[model samples]
Target: MLIPKLLWPLLEYEISTSSVESIEAIINTFTRKWLGFPPCQRDVAMYCRKAKLRLPLISIVEEYKCRKARLMTMLEDSDETAVRLFQSHLTINRKWKVCKAVEQEKKALK
Candidate 1:
């Protein structure tokens, strides 16, 4: 999940100058050396699967905006400390959601 996000830009930038064979060679070499296995079609499939697992960044940002708006509405009628605690909880829950998404992506790759 995380590796694809970082590597995608580099891959896109390289694709223009590299032949498909050379690109596969590069990926195969890396996987053989780092992962201790020769690259297979399954590795490519896994990348595709992981890519599909991503939520659109705009959607995530919009969700946070909505949550903040809701929090602000609640704050207007609620205790400051209580609202702060709820906000903190919401943030933690968001983090957990991200972790779960990544975990699911990993599972899909398998």
Candidate 2:
């Protein structure tokens, strides 16, 4: 019930990867409780296993990327000749993009 609501925004709007991660956490916590999965075990283990089993479980992160790209392409190739890229605002103190998050993760790995 809660999961559907949480997932809808990923397709509807642009959100940071961390936000998506928090959504993932909330979902995993609920799923873990429902499934009686262990406290120590990772939440990703379940999804990962489902993916390995070929049940076609795609994480929200992947969905976000695909949807974002599709939307961008649609805008780029749209009938409107004056379609332009959205300019982000200056008021936001922090803008967390997926690329930046990935770079940070890579740095942490190193």
Q: Which portions of model 1 miss their true places by more than 4 Å?
A: 1-58, 79-110
Tens digits of per-residue lDDT for model 2, 4-106:
5656776566566677777777767877788787889775676574355432345666666555555555555667666534312211214444334444655
lDDT by residue for model 1 over 1-110, one digit each (tens)?
Answer: 54345344533232222243354556456654675544454444323435755322222233333444454446545767766455333333422343344446558989
TM-score of each: 0.22, 0.59
Cα miss at 12, model 1 (Å)?
A: 35
Q: What ranges in model 2 sit over 4 Å off?
A: 1-5, 49-57, 87-110
What TM-score would you give candidate 2 relative to the actual structure?
A: 0.59
Best by lDDT: 2
C-alpha root-mean-square deviation, each candidate: 15.4, 6.5
